[model samples]
Target chain A: MTTGSPGNNTPLIEARGLHTFYGDSHILHGIDITIHKSETVSLIGRNGMGKTTTLRTLIGLAPPRQGTIKVHGRDIKKSKVHKIVHQGIAYVPDDRGIFPNLSLYENLIMAARSGPNGRDDWPLSRVLDLFPRLKERMGHMGNQLSGGEQQMLTIGRALMTNPDLILLDEATEGLAPKLRKIIWAVIKQIKKAGIATVIVDKDIKTLLEISDRNIIIEKGKIIYDGDSEKLIKEPEILKKYVGV
Target chain B: MEFSFYLIQLLNGIQYGFLLFLVASGLTLVFGIMDVINLAHGSFYMIGAYLAFWLTGIFGSLFLGIVLAIPLAVALGFVVERLAIAYLYKKGHLHQVLLTYALILIFDEAQRFLWGNDSHGVDIPAALSGSITLTDIQVYPVYRLFVSFVCIVIGVGMFYVIQKTKLGMTIRAGASNRQMTQALGINIERLFTIVFSLGVGLAAFAGMIAAPIDSLYPGMGDNILIISLVVVVIGGIGSIKGAFVGAMIIGVSSIFGKTLFPSMASIVVYAMMAGILIWKPQGLFKSA
Candidate 1:
């Protein structure tokens, strides 16, 4: 029910009154989120604040106990994860989740798919252009890549699916400062390409710089959701909700 | 034993190893990709041999019987996966073990009821029925060599499919992480059914080939199930390369034990499995 961006008219993903649970333990209590097309939205919070859970729910890794998830205005709460990908949502978990036995090229090519409506927007050449290291280590196994390389590969792999939107959880949880800069640069390039993204990372300042809007979550509820300028203007909300 | 006799035994071991590879390839894939421990896999092999025998008798051609048998076995595999194996996917390994073990019993009884309780012989194809003279006192059967060659070709074919193709990529991804692969838009459920059927087909193919050598009997599967498990364990649970190396090691070691130490021959495969399991625990070819 909240609109963060006025100019962005199209809603790519909308979650209404989502109630998610892990076994008997309730994790998300009726949280709602709206991500418009070509927008970068950040979910910034302390650990275990339902950020990852929200992302998980959207992609059907963990289906919500109650409420609705709509992709492109269609109900997708009951859809499987693979079907959800066709709905234009791609998820990259915190662990990177690369297949260690697969080669670098295999990793990228395995998830290789045309964009929504069979649009050949993102291809191997374009992906390799963004991260040329993937090309150099094309024959290298996934486990052999450095942390930074793995992060790049994970993002690149998701893009191979030619998704309309990507969900990145802890995109730079563990990385060198140089690698962090590279990832933020990539995110910027992704934004320039007109793809929507939902990001979850701990670096609030840099995350604020890359994202169009911010949502502060506390104990599974959205305490504050607003533009970055408004978020920066209010320090008490950040401290109270996200401990920043 | 003379030098020619020793040479013949070595060939025999390699041939046995090849046959084991064919059976274990399916077992390992089912274990690796579908994440299911199919205890009834050996039943497919037994039934395949029986089917081969019945078909060869009816068609009166060994080659035709083999040609007709593969797709039928594959169909059987598909039907079995859809009916029973699909339900046990979410259950524990204990459940899988029990259910598939029960399946073994069912298949065993069904085969006996259908084919009767006597061991039946299958004639070797005419093309491979002759033997080459090795020494003044010894001659080697051509059929065993042909079996080894066929198995090697299949093994190589399996490698190409798993390592070099797009479907292989999906399978590897599925095997390593099921949730992530599904999230990547691969229809893993359909893939599982296909993989299960292929695995069964491979096991049954091994059965078809070995029918002439091993003959068809009720309890043939009981020992093979255990031995194939040994191969899967020895090669690392889910690796095809591991299965090949494990099969070769088993093939060579069993024959060596039989020739060198008659008392240890029967237990050699078990001993190797136990020792290797203790050492690597993940098997010989634990690749990334």
Candidate 2:
């Protein structure tokens, strides 16, 4: 029976001894972490290192075989993905899973959750203001948006949910350098707005710049978890775990 | 046929197309948002027609019967989703097909168990019972025109709900990616249950409207389910606009096909579906 304010001093999300699988194949093993409020955490690793799997486990898309996931200090491992979301955790997957038939405005509207501010924070106007290009492409379908625009829409969509913690997997994957910079800038803005975030991506240096802390995972286990600065100074440790 | 007769038939085709739109829209929404393939959807329509038949007989007012029948059908839809459909959500599509197929059988048996396997007639209300005179020999049924009008109204209403409203957005998101919609704090399970019920309700409403002209009998929904599936395949999975367009195409083609080449009517519809599949392989409206 986990209970507390989703905000405040309570950790937004905490996973203890999480285990997950794809059929008989085990993907995540005893993964543990806590995302504090207003913190930007990054999960860095090579492909198939269980980064996306961890994110998937949190959302109940691939529910963990064992362990507990507490949202705002409450155990939610048993809850469905939608139920867990009601407790306040937003996830953006690696595939940029936009509804191809729906317009940009429609996509954003779908993720809108009632926030503490009620009508005050992150209205359609504010979202459009943040991604001005989205406003211009408001009527365009999701499939019509450029890759950069799609990335922007995806981030905008997560924010629209007003989640206490936003999980982004492969945030900068398959993007040009310019789009990547814009996304990092957007992440910085999100940090300033005081929303906690977990970003998983391949670009270690850029992610290190945006994320307050980084966790390096190898073969489904957290090999290293520490402040980004520490990992940068000790590139040897990064290479040891990530081989970058 | 005379040129005017062809024009009148064209009007009939449009009218029929519009009705198909009403039914297929709900079908597509259920497929898209809930990600559940409900084989028993046609049963809802059959049930609605039966309800219309009974209620009109009891109340002696077609309008009153239709109005009363809708809520009853929608309530039944809710019950079916809660009792059976919810259990099948995490299961694969194969399981859904099997379970819902079983549901159709169950519903058919139950309907027979209660209503008997006999044909029944429902009368159009007095307000819409008469016909508008076209030519000396040509008269259009007022009820059919009313049916078309009702469909248009419902289509416009559904479009508004799905496009201009907040709930529509959530539904679209749910269809696009079910996992992410839930992660965004949407009560997606409740959303699914609601969507399923609504889909059933729409199918039922179509059945009610159709009862007056087509009459009610056992296995009435069997052909409709197949035809609606054809509409879904033509439109693409999870696209409302696509369903509407597909319904229109199927409706017009079927009407004209029966007139032009009686033996080839059903074949032509299937061929159109095959052609569309070959061209897009994802239907006319693609949802990622």
Candidate 3:
């Protein structure tokens, strides 16, 4: 386990003992996660292994039955989803929830707001510049966009909020190879811009390469949490837990 | 009928349609965005008329009464949304129906207790009391024309807000996915409250403005409620544009039916609704 390094005093998000449930079915079992500043963390697990639930819990979408979630040492377990997000966290859901009725410009502009302490680092122009394809299709409604374009719009919409940390669930789920390359490139740029990201994607190889740390979950519990280099050295652990 | 007679009926139909639009727009938006069936929505209209009557009596100026009545209506809407409609969001349509239906009864009783079970009339503001002669024998009240003009201005403003503004975009986003909207740092609870209140305010404003023409009476909201619901259904629930189109259709058909087929005038609007539903069951415009 990696403790806080010197000069990295406070983690961006610190979630402890998260036990979440969907209806009567228990999903997460005492899951603990920590996302440090400017660090890219990859969350890898097989389908329906509580991967999405963890992201949902941290963002307060699915408030855990028993857990404490804190952002910058401020307890947010009982806070509303929007209030938690106001703490400089943005969540891109697995379904890429774009407003189908709204135009692309409307979608991006609606989520536009300054980050915590009025930080306005990411403006509309900056976001559109990041995803040139979106700028080209500004007048089109969200439903008119292709799946790849929708994914880019979702990410661009998230960045419009100028969030400090982004929880990306299924960053590249259903996409062509060329689109996937574009999404991965954007992810790297987002990471380069110093936004801490907890990415959940099926591409284990690319995740292992791009992430600073890798945390593997199995049946709702953390099986491996360590350096990316160390996880790369242990191929047996990856094959056993994630089948990578 | 003479050509001038048909022209007068057409103008009246358009005027009535505009009034119905004011009521149905709120209903459709509430149903679309919040997914709540607010059966008591018409109660706001009733209260608006009653408020105009009571306030006009107090202030002695219909113009001042209307101006003051709007804020009161809006404030009442805000309170009702916060106290009653807010809780119905998570509940199913059955619960929403039952609760809102109960609210209708409560508002009815409250109206009777406060204003008494008597019909009252509000005089048109002196400025709008004059009539313009369309023909030597056919004269149209300026107030009715003013009502149409005001409704048009409000409608245009509403369109601009929904189509071009940030708040409008967020509302559409909320309708699309409430969870995702909240995740994006939007205070959806606040948004819902604003939308519900706006719906209430619009309905009440419709009632207040229509009070002079329709008069104030007990259970007046019930009739308008049913008609507005028909308008909403025809428009497609949750679509403002659809509501406007539906209201106009019903307005014109009902007016013409009254003139041409007096015996079956009541059924004309319903027949029109059925016919439209058969052709385009999803409504003229899909929900926004």
Highest DockQ: give the candidate number: 3
Off by over 4 Å in 2: A1-9, A116-120, B263-268, B271-281
Assess candidate 1 and give its lDDT: 0.88
Model 1 fnat value: 0.83
Name the lDDT value of residue B95 in candidate 3: 93
lDDT by residue (B214-272, candidate 1, tens digit) is 87899688888888999999998778888888888898888888988998789988999
Please compute the TM-score of chain B alone for each predicted structure, in the order given: 0.97, 0.97, 0.98
User: iRMS value of model 3?
Assistant: 0.8
Candidate 3 chain A: worst-modelled 10 consecutive residues by lDDT = A1-10
Candidate 3, DockQ to 2 decimals? 0.85
The alpha-carbon lDDT assigned to residue A95 of candidate 3 equals: 92
Compute the TM-score of each model's chain A versus the native chain A and list the values. 0.95, 0.94, 0.96
lDDT of 2 by residue, A1-244 (tens): 1122345677888899989999998988899988898889999888888999998888778899899998877788888777776665677888878877678888888777665334235677877888888988988998899988999998898778666667898888899998888888888888888787899988888888888899887888888889988888999988877887
Residue A206 local lDDT, model 1: 87
Q: Sort the predicted structures by DockQ, highest score first.
A: 3, 1, 2
Cα shift from native, residue A11, model 3 (Å)? 1.0
lDDT of 3 by residue, B220-285 (tens): 999888999999999998888999999999888888999989999999999999999999998888
In order, candidate lDDTs are 0.88, 0.83, 0.90
DockQ of the candidate models in sequence: 0.67, 0.59, 0.85
Writing each residue's lDDT as its tens digit, candidate 1 over A126-202 gives: 99999987888999998899999999999999999888889999988899999998899999998888888999998
Residue B215 displacement (Å), model 3: 1.9
